[model samples]
Structure formats: C-alpha cells, structure tokens
Target: MRLLVVEDDRTLAGLLHKALTQEHHVVDVAHDGREGRELARSGVHDAVILDVMLPSMDGVEIAHQLRAEGIVTPILMLTARDGLPDRLRGFDAGVDDYLSKPFAFEELLARLRAITRRGAPVEDECLVVGNLVLDRRAHEVTRAGRPIDLSLKEYALLEYLMRNPGQALSRTLILERVWEYSFDSFANVVDATIRRLRKAVDEGYEQPLIQTVRGVGYKIKAQ
Candidate 1:
C-alpha cells in the first residue's frame, strides 16, 4: 500500500521511512506541513501518517482542510502533546486515530492497519498466492495447511514478493524495500533473506514459488 507521512523532524522522518519501507509499503514523506497537505490532497495514498506541531500548518488544520474538502482518507496522527483537548480537536477535524510520541512502531503499525481496514471496508486482510497464504491481520503464514515460521524481516520480504508476483524485482528495489541500508553496502542482505525464505517455504514442498530472474532480483510465482 502507498502511504503519506508528514513529519518535520528529519531524523524521525527517516526512521519512519525506513520502518514503513521495510514493511513493503511505499511511503511519501513531506517535511513541511503545507507540503504534506498538498501530498495528502493528491488522493493517491492508502492512508496518511501525520505529525502534529508542524510548521506553517499544524496537523489539526491539515486534517480539517482535508475533511472540509470531503477527502475521507484515514489519518493517524502522531504528537508529543497528549492532552484531551488536543485529542478532541484532532478527532473533531476527522482524524481517525492518535498516537503519542515515544510510541512503539508495533502499535503504530497496528493502528495503521486498523484504520486502513476501516477506511476501505472491502479491502482484503489476507494475501494468497497459490496455496501459500499470508494473513496480514493475524501476522501468520502457512503453505498448504502447514505452518511456516519466519523472522520479521523474512516475513516482510516474502510479503513484498507476494505483493508483486511474477515481476522481475531488482536487487536495488528489494534492498530499498526490505532493508534500511544502502544497496551498494547491503546488496547481500537480499540474497541472504531470499535463501532464508526458500528454506522456510520451499524446503519440504514440491513446487518452488520463489523464482530468480537472471540479472534482476526475485519473484514469487506458483507452479
């Protein structure tokens, strides 16, 4: 899914980008509140991750403007201020959820998934490729009724491949999406994770769903 993240702090914004991208979600970030508002108004995003106390236009106003314009994109606000009135203001402005600063990424991810689910009532929570299944809501993976164990990074990489099946995903693209390091330095990370994925998903199976495109990267295709 594509997402919009509006944050002023460069450091925090970088962290958010790394985290969200690692989960295979394409993220667009705006450091200025006004710029962020413009991006939010584009309507290309599945959801918005907003930070309050922004320069030029605050988060509440951005939310208010988007809502006033009848843009119903789900927004999850992040703020250091956790006062009732602030929360009330945000809610009044059509914010879907709020998370205080210093919060856990797990909680943020949960809120994001929940709000996106609520925003799009018909969206599928589970992803399927052949008999291999990934239940995003439950954070579980199984192949042909057999449970598959994977680390978080492994799960994320597999999900990405499953999301874009049969495509020749390049090493640079996978590196950008799966890990938080530079492609030149972390090129081996993708290879390592792909090996881990094959061990977990193809070790006991007759069909190998994960395939390599020569001179490119990898893909997940059913037999």
Candidate 2:
C-alpha cells in the first residue's frame, strides 16, 4: 500500500518512513499540512498519517477539508492530545484511527493495518489481466503460471497499467503517477520504461498485453 505521512518532527517522520518502507509500503513524507493536503489530493496514496499539530493547517482541519472534498482515503492521526474533547474532534473531522504520541511503534503499525483494511476493502490484493497476474501483497507477478521477475519501477509501472487496463495513459500522466513527480513530457523516460516493461511482460508471449497508441501513450489490453 502507498501511504502519506504528515509530520513536522523530522526525526519521527524519518523513523516512520523507514519503518513503513520496511513493511513493503510505499511512503511519501510531508513536513507541513499544506504539502500533505496536496499529496492527499493527488489521489495516489491509499491512506494518510496526519499529525495533530502542523505548520499551515492542523490535522483536524485537514481531515475536515478532505472529507468535505469527498476524499475517502483512510486517515490515521498521531496526536499528543488525549483529552476526550480532542478525540471527539478528531472523530468528527473523519479520522479513522488515532494514536497518542510517545506510543509504541508496533501499536502504530497495527493501527495502520486496521485502517487500511477498512479503507481499501473494495480493491483486490491481486490484479489479473488475461494470463498475467500481479499480486499486490506478495509483490509478485506471474503469467500462465510462470513466475516473472520485475524490478521495482517495472512492477510499479505494470501495476498502474493493469489498474487502468483499457485506458491510454499519457506520458506525463504515467510519469506523475508512477514516478511520483512531474517532468518534461517530451522526455523519453516513459517510452524507455515502457519498452523495458514490454520486454518483460510481452516478449515471449504470443499475444501482447501492453499496447502503444500512436501519437498518444500506452495501454494494457488483454487481447
């Protein structure tokens, strides 16, 4: 799962990032509430870890705005405040779970798992396209029962493509979504990456799953 961590304490944020990454989760860190909000709006992360106190906007207000915008990403709030009123406010603002600071990291991980299970129950952990199968939980891919080895970027690219099976994704869109940032659209990075991905996913197969739209971008079609 991909997660966004909104924390101002650099040390704690780093520790959290490392811990989440160690669990095989992709994590994006934001030191301030504004950046956190923007990253949340990008619709990339599956969940968010928000701090109660932030520089630009407080975590509760951020949760309020996200709820107001109809963004349903699960949020796990980290707060120093344990008062009943404060906890109620967090619930009112749409936080899915709360963790008091100076708490055990294990407890944090457990809460995160609980919230994510509730957040993404609609999404399957395994994605299937024709004979190709990508296991989101195992980080494994197979075709026709044959295992396929993929690099980190290759796996991410393939997962994105499979998610939007028949849609033609623009180069800029792929870069932003898969690479997690913006770059010149004219750059051949997307093309090059797709080339490498095609070699891995379609090279020996009689039928190709990845297709390129002339003058546009790429798509994954079963037939």
Candidate 3:
C-alpha cells in the first residue's frame, strides 16, 4: 500500500521512509504540514503518518481540515505531547490513532497496520476480479491460482486498477492517482508500465483482464 508521511524532522522522516520502504510499502514524504495536507488531499494513500508539530499548519489543523473536506483516509498522529487533553484533541481533530514520541519502531509498524486495516470500507484485505486475486495483506498476486511476481509499482498499479474494475480510467487519472503526476506528464512511463503489467498479469491467460479503451485509458475488465 502507498503511504504519506508528514514530518518536519528530517532525520526521523528519513528513518521512517527507509523502514517503511523495506517493509514493501510505497511511501511519499512531505516536510511541512502544507505539503502534507496537499498530498493527503490527493486521495491516494491508504494511510497517513502525521506529526503534530509542523510548519505552516499544525497536524491538528491538517487532520481537522482533511476530515472537514471528507477525506476519510485513516491518520495516525505522532507527537511528544502525551497528555490526556492532547490525546483528546488529536482524536477531536480526526486522528484515528495517536503515537507518543520516542516510540519503538515495532509499535509504530503495528499501529500503522492497524490503522490501515480500517482505512477504507471498499479496500478489502483481498481484491478480486474473476480468478485474478491480489492479496493486500500478503502482498501476493495470483491469476487462476497461479502465482504472479510483480514489482512494487506494478503491484500498486494493478491494485488501483482492480479497485476500479471496468471503469474507463483515463491516462491522466491513472498517472495522477497511481504515479502521482499531473495530466499527460510521464505519458510514456505510464504506457511502459502498463505494457509490463499486461505481460505479467495476462500473458498466458485465455481472457485478458486488463483492457485498453482506445484513446481513453485502461481498466481491469470486470468479470
């Protein structure tokens, strides 16, 4: 799953990024709260790890604004302030979970997993279309009971496609949501990735699940 980490502390942010990436998660980092809020509004992440103290805007306001704007992605707030009132305020601001400072890495990971499980009602633990299955938790993909190996980006793209089965997702929409790029930016990259993904997911299958919509884009044809 893709995650957004909003932290101003450079060292801590770097550590979190490295650790999460190692755990097979695609991570995007923002140094300030404004940038963090913008990233959060993109509606791409499964979960967000946000720090309380921030530049331009505080984490509390970020969470509050996100909720007010109807962005339901689960947020795990990190802060050194562990007082009861502070925790309540974090909760009031729409943070799903709170982690105090100087926390163990294991605890953080556990919290992340827990919050992400409750991230969205539509994002099931396993995504399926016909015989194609993508296990979100195990990070495994199978087509007709045959295991398929996929790189992290390919997996992300496939997951996005599966989530919106049969929808004519434009290239711009795919690039923005999956690649996090603006319209028509990196068009070739999107094409290349789609080609690779098709080969991996549909090469020997009798029915190709991934379909192109001519000038529109691609979709995982619903069964």
Q: Name the best candidate (by TM-score).
A: 3
Better of 2 and 3 by lDDT: 3
Q: In model 3, where do residues sit more than 4 Å from their true spots?
A: 42-44, 117-123, 183-185
lDDT of 2: 0.86
Query: lDDT per residue, candidate 2, 1-223, as tens digits?
Result: 7789999999999999898877777677889999889889976577899999999999999999999999999999999999989999999999999999998989988888798788375457788999999887677899898898877678878988888889998888888777766776544888888889888889998999999988778999954
In model 2, what lDDT does residue 175 have? Answer: 80
Q: Tell how far residue 211 is off in model 2, in angstroms.
A: 2.3
Score candidate 3 by TM-score against the native: 0.87
Query: How many steric clashes does model 1 contain?
Result: 0
How do the residues 127-220 of candidate 3 rate in per-residue lDDT, one tens digit apiece?
9999999987788999989999998879989988998999998889888777768868688888899999999999997999999999898999
| Between candidates 1 and 3, the TM-score winner | 3
Q: What is the C-alpha RMSD of each candidate to the true structure, in Å?
A: 5.9, 2.6, 2.5
- Runs in model 2 deviating more than 4 A are 119-123
Q: Could you tell which candidate, 2 or 3, scores higher by TM-score?
A: 3
